[model samples]
Target: MDHSYLSSKESLDIPYITFPDLLRKWAEKNPNKTAFIFVDEEVDRYELSFGELYDKATKFAKALIGHGVRKGDVIALNGRNLPEWLIACFGIQLAGGSPLCLPYLQKKNDFVKVCSKLGRVKMLIIDPGSDGQNCQFLKEMICTDFGTNNVELPEIPDLRQVFLFNHHASLPSVNTVAELCSREWDVDLPRLDPEDLGLILLTSGTTNTPKAVPYSHHALVITAYNSIHLMKTSGKYDSLYNNRPFYWIGGFVMWEVNSGGSRVTLINAMKSSSMATAAAAVKTCEIIAREKVTVALLVPSMLDLVMKKNISLRLKTIVTGGMIVHSSLLKNIHKLCDEFICMYASTELALIACNTFTEKDITNTTKGLLSCRPLPGIEIKVTEDDGFLLPAGQRGSIQVRSTRRFNGYLNQNLPPESKETLERTGWFCPDDGGYVTEDGELVVEGRLQEIIQVFGWKKMFPFEIENVIKTKSNVSSAIVMSLKDKETGDLPPFAAIVYHPNDEESCESMQDYIRKEFNITTENRMLEYLCVPRGIVSFKQFPVLANGKPNRRAIRQIILETVDSEKYE
Candidate 1:
């Protein structure tokens, strides 16, 4: 078999419509049906029906138009998964503006950089800061950047309006959502085409700075429709609980407003702890149990914490992706649900492939990462760096073409590094290296840039070493990253591990075991010495992104700092 696969499955006839049109259809069909559930904690839970949601969004859109919002304008949205966030997102599209979802960045400088890069954000809608002090600080930052009339900063010249949510702060030149919603206009909402831009998403900059990726309305609708069908196969279309933030791709693409009348549950990020903490995982399980959620989409890191709780939950299906789906994670997640769906996807191409794994699938698999077949309407191929096709069982760059591919970046003049992602041909490279097995299953290795290079040309992917470390019974999670040698300028791998709580084995002993495992040399392990990590460190919790994926960049820095500090002390 060749190293390419085209989905031969027939596709459902998904509707081609704009976001506003989708909301209209669902609202008219199921007026009283609960569209979304906002779970704040154990005590507070709020639900919005289809009719109420549609009416609120329509009013918000009219208010936006009264504020001089025109078609094709770009608006920046900064908030968590609140009811206001939902209204603002859909209202912007209904008013004919694309909403650019903002990541949760604390630094003022980071926030300024994002707005400057967009070059033409017409308005900004943000949440009220933590308290009065925070609100004051944010007021100063916005006035200094956007409220100044004296200095005409070429960057963000179009940003003249600002709106704050759920606050009555008397900040200079700042508008509140209440002020906007109170105003109504007799003007009709603009009719938009299906190909109009829907929203802009920021990529996870694990290796580099995040870029702005835009998607059209039709693309988002089709993506969600196909995904609903895929999940329906396992009888999991009733209700979903997703903790991933609205800024992330998994937040919107996985579930959208449609005629299917699917219900979604969103956790209050302000009340919840970080996903790295056991508390957050406990809260996640609690919500799934209380809300009667049939399906949940989580990252592997969050699942790792839930599995450690040893508390079985009642759910129909559990979906996970956005990290290496470790075999151990797969082996244990079954206790919490009836079935497990592992997906391989990215922000560029939503939902590449997914498979429902069971106890038997995990027991029989020999690969470190399980292989999944391509989803319907997607084409996968293994190719060399120059785009030459590779044969089956040969590792190479992985490229994909799908019907739901994203529109070009907001800044089409991409940086040199990202130029190779979209080719003159239609194929887009996700910068991953993998191959097709003889059975036509796609097995993904880690990112090609993450390969560890030691003394000369001998290099290996970090997953090779990570798989070996995970074999230990006491280890909960392991991540291997390449560290550079100062004197020889060689890159050797080092491991960062999190052990099971209350385990009798000490960190020093685990380090010694890893070192001893690498030193063992046999005919099959001759190159094992070269692949060995230079050192090992223990972590209580790994730093994670807003999307719950491990923040590899931050993790690398912490590992280096911890090792260096220990060496000096």
Candidate 2:
């Protein structure tokens, strides 16, 4: 936790460069070096070397320019993690156009609504259907309604064309990316500026409408350098295994590719499915050991699965974040690697803070409040509702200021809450509440807006009850959130718990224990009576987002339905 050993650089010290230029630098320096490793189930995989990736991306860039992709055009790239996805993404940047990364959704209305929200998408390049024939939904939409001018579909007004991967069936009015990439076009690609819009990343649409977050080439490079700096590795041979989707900031190639280090990603056989399956996790662990991956970025869920395999994994470091690092998981870190790192980051603000825990450090630290040291170039503080800066150890709203903050959202009306959060003077509120310890470690409690109002004016953070629930011997992990009472319109807390595998308790018994614990805590005045959860739901494991954070939105819906069913019974 020493700032003296951390990576630090003034804003001017970091190099600002374009993505295409960065790719070219790597290709020239390490031409034959493996840049990307794409793995499938059963250890089947392929490698994309830097030279080959650059050559393909350049050709694809020319193809894009030939297809009328001008600078600043927002082209939608929707698909699973594949070699083609990375190539097409870099090609878009090479052509001076911004690639709008979209998840591979199957429903027609869902796809159209997401595309329409961005306003006038220039083109869409998506993968084939699960059957590998074609995107049936899109084929139906374009052929039936989008004849020639696409005048019939007002939703996607500016959509000029749709292109599927070559494996799909040939259909009328649809083009194939293979044909485009194979086209020998001599069109001049536009010159790209370092500050040009590089790519567009959508906010994880778990809670609200997915907002478009645009990052410039400069921002990408700066963050990429910071990421590489964090690995604290000098050799280019150190490999990373990351299963996060390419659309996510965590899985972004900019982070690892800049280091000239190789990265391995899990490629789901079914294109539509994005979740990392248990089979995939086992395969990932096999790849990690076989390939001798030094630093791996496995989300807590994936880590738990990998660890359950009881494989001996000794690596340089294992990086995790975007979820609460449970005590059980933290305790098992020594079995995985020499150093464990948990980060605090968001789409809006890049890498905010991280804690590097050695085995000894983990043993010495308190298990309750997880703390992180702020990264270089990031200024974070906890402030009261009135904008008063709270002293160390006093919990309040967390705000951050950084030069590398994302460019504003694109083509969407800002929600009032989002508007207020960003409109603050020189600070961006990440909607998280936490405190800073006297040692300067930042402790993130939970979401600020997720505070549950139980009685007329009594409110409590979800973590307050969650922390208490996790203290039970049988509980492995617990998530507490508020649900609106249909009858009374009050927000009361509910608990979703994952019990220890060996110490599993029956639901009836666990409920009784939870109530007893709550009663004891209330009697001792450690917690208020109103803070007790109204209902308890047990889970083998909690559902998580693609980025590996607990999926509270889905959890809330599940809890609501469970409560309703119980009442009916």
The candidate that wins on TM-score is: 1
The Cα local distance difference test for each model comes to 0.71, 0.72
Give model 1 RMSD, 1 decimal.
4.0
For residues 2-65, what per-residue lDDT tens digits would candidate 2 score against the true structure? 2211123433367767877777888999889988888875568799999888888888889888
Q: RMSD, each candidate, Å?
A: 4.0, 4.4
* Residue pairs whose backbone atoms clash in candidate 1: none
The TM-scores, one per candidate, come to: 0.87, 0.86
What tens-digit string does per-residue lDDT give for candidate 1 at 336-455?
777888788888877788777876666776446777777778888998777788889887888888877653576546545445555455577888888888888888888977767756
What stretches of model 2 exceed 4 Å from their correct place?
1-12, 144-152, 170-174, 269-281, 305-309, 415-424, 453-460, 463-478, 484-490, 497-508, 516-522, 525-531, 537-551, 561-569
Candidate 2 structure, TM-score to reference:
0.86
